[model samples]
Target: MTRSGTDRRLSDDEMASWLPLIRLVQLLPQALDRTLREEGGINHAHYAILVTLAQDAEAPPTLGEIARIAGLSRSRLSHALDALARRGWVERTSCSTDKRTGSAVLTEAGRDMVRRAAPAHVAQIRALVLERLSDDERETLTHLLGKLLPGIESAV
Candidate 1:
């Protein structure tokens, strides 16, 4: 079938192709959330925030920066940080350069928590996602995803 113009709507095959990706995106987060919540008393987003702080070169990042990196709103991030702080998993410190700005640091306990949670998280990811792909498919998917990333970043 041909459209009147060059711009065409998605074909059935194209739509079908996206179904797996869409389902994966939806289910993976839920699965991860369930696993983390059960095992670590933290949701996937919380785990991600802690891991991001742990991986940061400074071992801490400004709340604003953390919110940006975490793709969460400042208010939402603040709430999450508050929860984490209450759980004793993270510490907020006044920035040396800017007293008004605060940084969130993963505590020793947080580090240990993340370290413990990591293996199960990695295993789950591998089992659900990576292990399903053949080596060639993995390489191709990585390359294609890398190529698409710049455009996504630019759009954002």
Candidate 2:
């Protein structure tokens, strides 16, 4: 069922409500990617993969799991893993439980890289985003985002 032309257009309040989120979705990833590529010699996607492995209970995670968590396709994740492996940031080992599955392990070097990258990343985040918000605004933003996250995850 299609709406009439007037109804199809976004309402002013709807535009106002969603514009910031749309801008954020467009800009944040590009900014973060640029920063990580410049300072860490890795893109944001690669950083996410490493961080996911680092956060794993085993300090490593199966390739499929990492791909899912990172929201990347298997081929893209495989290519990123290959690059990380060449940099000595990650090591791939055949899973003991499932020979066909491979796991990516974060190396000491990778942990050190993440540590080095953290300060600059946090500074950039603070300067560009967090510093602009008041305490109450920050809390509200967090709460609102938290509320929205489950719905987004369910869609995915």
CA error at residue 97 for candidate 1, angstroms:
3.0
**Model 1, residue pairs in steric clash:** none
lDDT of 1 at 71: 65
CA error at residue 45 for candidate 1, angstroms: 0.4
**For every candidate, C-alpha RMSD to the true structure in Å:** 3.0, 3.5
Give the whole-model CA lDDT for all candidates, comma-separated.
Answer: 0.86, 0.86
- Superposition TM-score, candidate 2 onto the true structure: 0.80
Q: What digit string (tens of lDDT, one per residue) describes model 2 on residues 57-85?
A: 94357888899877788999999999999
Kindly report which residue stretches of model 2 are placed more than 4 angstroms away from their true locations once superposed: 1-7
lDDT of 1 by residue, 1-156 (tens): 653556567678767878887897799899999999888988988898998889858435788878867767788998999999998999888888889998788889999999989989999999988999999999999998899878865675
